[model samples]
Target: MAATFRRAMDALYLLCVIVGCTALVLISAIIPWAVFTRYVLNSAASWPEPLAVLLTIVLTFIGAAAAYRLNLHMNVGYFADQLPQPFRKLLELLVQILMALIALFMIVWGESLVEVTWHNTIADFPFLSVGVTYLPIPIGGLCLLLFIVERIWLGIPPDPIPAHHEVAPFE
Candidate 1:
């Protein structure tokens, strides 16, 4: 059961990474194009900014889930690290509980937001429902909830991926 859970979580994390990276590349290209169209061509594009914002929302939420699974989320461990082992463990548990609560809040409120905005359409893209834009919120929260459960009930994730090879800068 544990193994299956881990495999599932890994797959989810990989999916999030792919989505986030795709969004990053797309946003990078779109912004420059928007700028060029606005300044160089003297005809500002209407779709790029709104599209970029949507992509950013997706990237931030999904990337955050992946990062949490990988233990890449920010940590201010100086104070906690100074505590004794038992206290440290307690603190860790406390943090996980707090994170789980936050994830739950995201899921609950995000769904409400999505439902409330379901009938509305993006200003620039009238055909697209605004609710669709908010989907990443609950989806990411779901992913995060799973990861937090795994961490609290299962165990710490393995170490970070090791570099495949060392490259010399001069080479």
Candidate 2:
């Protein structure tokens, strides 16, 4: 059962990474086109800016959930590491509990936000509902909650990538 759950989460993490990367790529391509059209072509395109904003939303929320699952989210662990072993474990549990609460908050409030905006259409993309763009909020929240459960239940999974490779810093 645990193995199955972990496999499911692994799949979900992959999906999140793919979606986030795609959004980022689209944003990169769209912004350059928008700039080119506005300056070089002398006529601005109406769709790119708003589309970029929407993709940014996806990148932020969905990417964040993937980061959290991989234990890559920003955290200051120096103080916790300095504590005694039992206290350190306690603090870790406390942090997970806090994160779970935050996930629940996102699920509840984000759903309400989506429902409120569901009927509204974007001016630039008239066929797309505003609420559809906000979907990543709740979806990411749910993914976060599942990952939190996995962490609490199974402890941290082994890093998929081996740690022996050295990272080179950019000049």
Q: CA RMSD for every model?
A: 2.3, 3.0
Give the Cα-based TM-score of candidate 2 against the true structure.
0.94
In model 2, the runs with Cα more than 4 Å from the true position are 166-171
lDDT string, candidate 1, 46-164, tens digits = 99999999999999999999898878889789999999999999999999999999999989999999999999998899999999999999999998999999899787777457555
lDDT (10s digit) by residue, model 2, range 39-75? 9999999999999999999999899999998898898
TM-score of 1: 0.93
lDDT of each: 0.91, 0.93
Model 2: lowest-lDDT 10 consecutive positions: 161-170
**Scored by Cα lDDT, where does model 2 land?**
0.93
Per-residue lDDT for 71 in model 2? 93
